[model samples]
Target: MRHSIAIVSLVLFVLSMALLLTLAKQAYIPRKEVRDLAKIYLNTTYNPWNKKFTAMSPEGVTAIVWDYRGLDTVFETAVFYLAIIGSIALARGIGKYSKPTSDEKKLGLSLIVKTVTRITTVSIIAVAVSIALHGHLTPGGGFQGGATAAVAPLLILIAFSQYFLLERGVSKDLMLVIRSLGLAGIGLTAIAAYFIGVAMNKYAFVLQNQAKPLSEVSIPAYIDGQLISGTLWFFNISEFFAVMAGFTIVLILLVIPERAFKSSGGEEK
Candidate 1:
């Protein structure tokens, strides 16, 4: 039975690779001419001479995601937030992971893996921060950076054990707080310019990045002469924390052994 399954898997893998290779000839190739909507974005994304229309970010993709179609991104973020909340509700009061139980004392991988994780985890976190913070100037943005940040804790959980993180005060409650704050920050950043407009009695739109022709209100694109690209930088940083903590919460909950829950008289969700 095992050999039969293996033969089927091999055939499936071969077929998938062959199909991908065929598509690589044409489907994945870049088109030379600019399309209509894409051309509009490329022209206005970082144009200082066209501040009223521009998102004022070097990275066109980030501008499009957070500025051009921001409301759509907000809805997507809300869906992820709701999913996390649902998981937390389902997994309530199952375990306190501050210290390991006797059965867990012998957990974690070998010393070589642990040592490598220690080095790589810190570097990975640094890269994630840079990716989120500099997203308006480069390729990556909030979701990408947050996903990258989550990998560090995941590696530590596998390599050095969950107790290592628990001992270091990386608890679910703390993560929840961080996640909540990040979400709040994103919300505030979204409406910040609108509130300013109300106070000054000028026209402004929610999620507005650069000042439009009708509204003089604008989120500062620069801070102390540094190009933060208005709401894009704040959104990226907030989302980085929110996604990182949310994913870490999921990991911590998932790492709990079934036997552990059973022993504690907690029914599995």
Candidate 2:
């Protein structure tokens, strides 16, 4: 049976590779000159002269994702967060009744691996932060950076142990709080201009990052002359935390021992 499964997998893999290679020959090449909808986004993404259409974000993709069509991305992110919330609810008390044993505390890889992971984890977090904070300026953004940051926790879980992380206050409750804050930040940032407009008795859209042709209200594109790209930076930072914490929550729950579920008389379904 195992051999049969392996052969079938190999055959499927080969077929997939062949199909991909065949399609590669017909890959569409982009035109040299920007035109149509893309041209508009590129022209206005960072135009200081055209505040009406400009998102004030230089990075076209980031501008489009967070400023031009932010609501769409918000809904997409909401769906993912909802899934994580459901997972958390399902695993409600799987680990509550079980405490890590003294031996579990000492369980991990060799000293050299642990030392390497210590340095590696720190570097991973640093890179992730750089990716998130500079997302408005570069190709990387919140989701990418947050996903990268979550790897550090996974590494610790593997190199040290889940108990090590939990002992260090990396609890699900704390992560959940952080995730909630991130989501709140996103929600607030989305309507920041609207609130400001209300206070000033002006018109502004819910997800307005910059002033439109008709609306006078806009989020500040710079702080003390430092370019923040309006709401894009805030969105990236918020999403970074949200994605990282959500992933960490799932990882923590998965690492909780099956026996932990047994102690709570729960099957961890």
Candidate 3:
């Protein structure tokens, strides 16, 4: 039976590899240019001069994410927020974990590793912030930047103990607060136009921008003579904090020991 299973597995793996190769080869075959929904997005997304609907962002992906398909992105962020909250709740329920004491936690790496990580951590964080801030004009955005920033905490965890982070005033509770605040910011940004219009007795739809009729609410695209792409920048900024906090909370929960959970009676009765 073991021999037959191994033979079958081998055959399946080989067939899968062949299928992948065939698909890859087919992908290289050139096809004629076809006008489609994608072409519409590509054509209109980057036009700052066009007066109809101005995203004011050269990065098509950013425009699509924050302007064209903003509601979808907002819901996606909400889903992600819920998922992170669920993970933390589940972790807490399964194990009433607390931050491990310095002595209880594993010792960090050697001096050399610590030194390198310390230097790189700052650089990594700076780059991540740049990516998040410039998301409107560039290829990167909030999610990408936040995920990249998360590496800083992880690296700190590796080179310096979690206790060290806690000592520096980083905590799960703090992260949760920050995450909540970021989500709130996103929600407020989405509705600001609508509510303002309502107060002023003007016609405005939810999530409407300055480009839309009767909506006076708009974020400035230029700040101090620099183009920031308005609401896109705000969205990117909010998502950056939300994502970073969510990941940080998860990481902190993961590193706590099983014994801590037991002490707190986290196991199901």
Candidate 4:
């Protein structure tokens, strides 16, 4: 009887969740209506005579995430970094072992790998830079771009092992460094916000607008609802670096083997 009751309870819980999700999915109004409402709610007229910015609304979403909500993002990044550093420290350490190593299979392999590495490295760098620079104007920004930048190193690592790069190694310490820098940057941004005597959302907008001069610069509704400030670009950049470093660390830990070389088949002993 108890088991049956528990099963019924579980079913009820699942059904409730399903109902909520369905409601949420169907909650949004039609796009045309939404746009019309936005126009009505957001449309503002310049009233210099009354010294009033009448009907002015901010880019609320940008403000919330980058400014007011930035603290959350900062702590989140901090936690992310802490986790990454911990993993690096735990997984990679001072150890020694030997195994057969080789890149001796084909003459063209070295050339191909080298070419691919160079092309990929350069291309990724360019893309990252572009994304970072135009983060405000377009969809992607620094965080996305920076993460993309991190890929270049991973590619290089794949093409050439630590031995080739003057004994460069990816270990726990390196992860700590990358994570530390990222977290530190985020912390500093937060601290700066406090000193500015404004909430995170407000600050994000101030900085973002300062960095990029957009004709239609207004805080989104979400941001207007809070104190976060900075252009969405800044937040985007932060996310980019955060994600980039994260994936890079994961790639190193997972893909870069202890022994990066081995013998090919059919070798005469």
Candidates' RMSD to native: 4.3, 4.1, 4.5, 11.1
As a TM-score, model 3 comes out at 0.82
Could you give candidate 3's per-residue lDDT for residues 1-269 as a string of tens digits? 75998999999999998889788885354568755977777777766676456667878898888888989999898788888879877885553545645564357888888899999999999999999998977779999999999989989987887777988889999998999898988888788777777787877766655455445556567889888776788889999999999999999888776677677775645
- Candidate 4's C-alpha runs over 4 A off are 1-30, 35-64, 89-94, 97-110, 162-175, 196-242, 258-269
What would the per-residue lDDT of candidate 2 be over residues 1-269, giving only the tens digit for each residue? 75998999999999997788678866455769876898888899989998688888778988888888899999999999989989988877764644555665368898899999999999999999999999988888999899999999999998998878988999989999999999999999998999999999998889888888889998889999989988999999999999999999999998887787787776546
Of candidates 4 and 1, the better by lDDT: 1
Computed on alpha carbons, the lDDT of every model, listed in order, comes to: 0.90, 0.89, 0.82, 0.53
- What TM-scores do the predictions have? 0.85, 0.86, 0.82, 0.54
Best by the TM-score measure = 2
Q: 1-269, model 1: which lDDT tens digit per residue?
A: 76998999999999998788787874455679878999999999989898789898999999988999999999999999999889988887664333455665467887788888999998999999999988999899999999999999999988888778988999898999999999999999999999999999999999998899889999888899999999999999999999999999999888876766776777657
Which has the higher TM-score value, candidate number 1 or candidate number 4?
1
Clash totals in order: 0, 0, 0, 41
Tell me the lDDT of candidate 4: 0.53
Tell me model 2's lDDT, rounded to 2 decimals.
0.89
- Candidate 2 regions exceeding 4 Å error are 1-35, 93-106, 266-269
